[model samples]
Target: MPTSSSSPPTDSPTTGGHRFHALRVVIPALIILVWLAGAGIGGPYFGKVSEVSSNDSTAFLPTSAEATTVQNRLPDFLGEDAIPAIVLITSQQKLDSADLADIRTLAQDLAGLPEVAGAVSPPIPSEDGLAVQIFVPLDADSEVDAAVEALRAELAATLPGGLTSYVTGPAGFAGDLVEAFGGIDGLLLLVAVIAVFLILVVVYRSPLLPIIVLVTSTFALCVALLTVWWLAKAGIVLLSGQTQGILFILVIGAATDYALLYVSRYRETLRDHDTRWAATKAAWRGSIAAITASGGTVIAGLLCLLLSDLQSNRSLGPIASIGIVFAMASALTLLPSLLMAFGRSAFWPRRPQPIGDDVDPQVAHLPARGVWARLPRYVARHARPIWIVVTLALLAGTLGLTQLEAKGVPQSDLVLGSSEARDGQAALGQHFPGGSGSPAYVIADEGELQDVTDALLGTEGVASVAVTAADSPSGTAPVTADGVQPIGPPGTPAPDPTVDDGDVLLQATLAYPADSAAAEDVIRQLRSDLGDRAAIGGPTATDLDSNNASIRDRTLIIPIVLLVILVILMLLLRAVVAPVLLIGTVVLSFAATLGISALVFDHVFDLPGADPAVPLFGFVFLVALGIDYNIFLMTRVREEALHHGAREGMNRGLAITGGVITSAGLVLAATFAALAVIPIMFLLQLAFIVAFGVLIDTLLVRSVLVPALGHELGRHLWWPSRRIAAASDPAPAAVRADTADR
Candidate 1:
């Protein structure tokens, strides 16, 4: 490296006066204290996240959807809106009179609870006489999970022996979803931190280094949570368990990835600089560009979700973007301060050797011996063959994309592992109409009520239809093509259908399971027949609308994200071809990840299907994160090419940036893998896809494929850039010899 002076600068610790030295120490301490205070204040917000967050799918459905329209009109016709929970009690043998009486008593007790809304239905017997089902109206505004737990506990305490019970319905499934995400606050964070820590220990082979990196990540997450929690509490944005979990993982992974880059640069600078101040300055100056650009790309990609119709996706865009911003800030500010405070001792026994003023900064980055060093030479020679083979292999991975199914998993399948709601759903389906508790809400004008009711009744999958009747003994009265059925003797009159603002409400019980594709099909068919005559909304319709919204979002957002990232790369690298090539490779690698993940999900895990948001989330994370490695490598390659020629620069940059980029990728993948501990299918699938995709990015694409392509393209990789175009020519003899020596 060229030295501007024979000694350290005046601002550096060694040459600075007492006052200047004091400034350096106090500044770093102040930065540390500020972060510590922020983290301390933010830590408690983790437990409080659930207070402002919701797992209700209907709450996030596209407002323009028919389901949302019907949902809005429901409360006006049906009094206060409520969620239905089916209490299913089954026995091996036929239920006797005493058994039925006990079940009714239990139902009465459940009805008396504060969680129950309006009136609870009388126990209805099944055709086999082996099962009794009770429909309980749960207060939708209250905590569904806690209410379900209370109901379950009550049943466990009072129900007679030989009777088995399950609470299943929209309310029950919602409860299950809340319980599944219960781990996000504690277990998910712990697992992700532990996983990243272990990987960091292996990568750095130092005790304190991993802890320092984790501290930065954790602090970033803490502050991000604090910001998001308040925003959610103020109703500025929606918060959900899924988005919160993603925020946790994204902050940790992104912060740590940026930290690794800084550390790598700092280590190099420390070897040639005498003072920690000098090292910190050089390192920060070197790594900040790449770190900020990487974070900005991720933020941009996440923000595209703002265009989504689903509230959950729109919320995630800003929430995760906030996380990325904090992550970058922590890495650039907090981590550097910590490193300055610790100095070289943070590395312990593995401390980098100081080379003093004689060290050549350009050559110091060359790995003495490693796969990274050797692989570059291999790529330089076999550029064409290696890239072609790697391209073909990645393409082969895409073949399984045909098996991928991302329409949407059933509500029961949302939670992985054992699900009481899923079990209850199955039991309820076996004993009664599959859609008993969760009925479809159809809103129509009073003039079209009969037409809409007849259409719903004629629908292939509808089991029963009823109109909301406030005057009836039950909340609803039976309806058919013949209009409302009589409630009593022949002389009694039928209950009048409740109407509000010229619109009436009708409930359709689907013969198929409420969340089944068959049920969704029924809703679609009804909408087609009814057209503007009525609107259909229910648990199934909410799910259907959410899925449709996700599909629309992914279709629109994917291309926009690609365009955003492509433009960012062009600006960052000042080259069109390099960004396009890098984008192509990452896109292929992402496809491969999805393809392989599909096979694993289908054949190994036997999962039902994926939520529509999986591919979109995976794409946002993998493509943005995967490009980070490219930025790290290409930035250095472009820097080296300015002096060393294209061939020499490609080899040198590949060899030099390889270790740090690989380590960064590993940390990111490991942190994302921790998402699997949450027991949510969406998180699990995303975990696998991103983790696997990142490895492919670091190991194969960045390590071999990009290098080979860059080598073959040579100086042309930086086309339209006058600087790189000039540097692509043959280097001087001395420069070639210096490169050869490394």
Candidate 2:
């Protein structure tokens, strides 16, 4: 096995080398200045994201979905773009005439609010007479959160004594969603940056180095967001609060990870090279392939979302891919420049001194004696046993995968923290039909309107059915077995049903909460019964369609992502066996992550349930990002193995790469963990899954299992490749002279 020599080689600087040396200082300075200007320009866009982004669930549905079709036709039926807010006023005692009068006054006052789209519904007493429900239509395009808050404040100030009120419906949910994501721009970014900074500080034990790394990541995120914001503004892609938050974290974590790899190479090169320019050149060469391959793999996996049936997933593909592009660019350019400018001082008190340049041999060539050193020895000594035990343990964890319930969760439970919308949903179910404000919308041929209405009314979960009417005072006329009912007195003429393109709209109030599983089941049954004859849509249908689409996306995209990543790995490692081995370990790590997360979610946190997309996203992130560490480790191993035999290379590679890879893992894990503070269930679940998966990948799979398995396989690990023989071949004259000197 090749070992480090006491002597070092002198560079014979040609004219090209001299020109390259001059360019390094000038080029890095230019790169740093450009990034600083970009960060300054892009940082303020964080607060303006809401201007270009949406949280509306309906907007994210597939265009072909029933919900999307209904959503598009809604404005035509209603005469305006609006979202209903159901206000439930409840009292322990039956309301008297004065109470009814007060409720009427409250409704009248709500109608006067600027955001109120039309006349607010008069108080309609429940069958028990202890509760009254009022429907308020708020302009969907307005500031929904502010409008909801206004409604809540007005109700609180003017409600009759001993009565409780809640604002719950589509608008209410939108308001809650906006509130839940309110922290994405500030708290999420702050938490992620702080977490990464702390981890970097611990790893590097340097003040300036962590800042430099963080600046690189922050600059990448700022530029990515700036580009994404404009793209969203131009309507090229849908930007939601969910995607924005994810982009922020993905950029920061990925950039920092890439920065860590570069830093490690730079530090190693500094120990050998006296000049910062030479060290930077060598480090950039060593790190570029691994970093580029890792970033490309993640981008490819994310872009696979374009094939998803859900717009939310499809939009995230390009949005996050853009972020990854910036991350890679910044890591390859900006971070390198920063580290080169700082040079050895970037390591501070622990700065690496050049070997054999007035340094003690004992201090310079001190053999690694930490856990990193011992870990390689352990892997070499017990290769088979270690891999077998780790594999068995990972497989055992997969058993818990069956316990994961990822069909979907109720919209009321979408936000983990306290929510007025969720509370109002509970109150709404208690007083009136659970789907009072939000009704299941159906569009059918005018000829079959009555038939579709009958089908909907006959459905088990349907409370009442009404048809959109042009002349009705309330915008909808009641639908009965006979026909559309009169809006007012018996003598009043029945309003004609609204018709557009020979289709009439029907609204069916659900007997259960609009976001409940029972409502979704009813929607599914209706779709099954009606087929393409009628398009059924609403909040319930939207959830149902989204869940179905997510399931489909998981089935289709997961395999494609795996295949794409495997090919990238093959090209990267230049060997079939090594890439397959790396991919297998990452897959096992992902399963273990999900399995353990399933147990934790079900038993520990006791979450209601997860979105169907959770597992799919977890798999994509874990496998792609998890494979990142393996790529870092294995690429170095392959490089070392080409000089030293496979066994010796594995030992040296694991030992040398251990600390940086672990730190990178921790940094990535910490940035993801910051998602927990967002207060949204999907993000929270994703945070845990990816964060846990990364830790498992770094600590167990990459650190122990992979190295052990590679050692067990020996040179055959590079099957079909005779590159392993290069370790035994004599060096060329130039290399021999360099080796003799070094």
Winner by TM-score: 1
Candidate 1 per-residue lDDT, tens place, 679-698, comes to 89999999999999999999
Consecutive 10-residue window with the lowest summed lDDT within model 2: 1-10
What are the per-residue Cα lDDT tens digits for candidate 2 across 118-208? 7677788998888999989998888789889999999999887899998989999999989899999999999999999999999889989
lDDT of 2: 0.87
List RMSD in Å for every model shown: 2.5, 4.6
Per-residue lDDT of 584 in model 1: 95
> What's the CA error at residue 351 for candidate 2, in Å?
1.9
Please report, in order, the local distance difference test score of every candidate based on alpha carbons.
Answer: 0.88, 0.87
| TM-score per candidate, chains pooled | 0.96, 0.94
lDDT over C-alpha atoms for residue 195 of model 2: 95
Clashing pairs in 1: 1-360, 1-361
**Total backbone clashes of candidate 1, pairs 3 or more residues apart or in separate chains:** 2
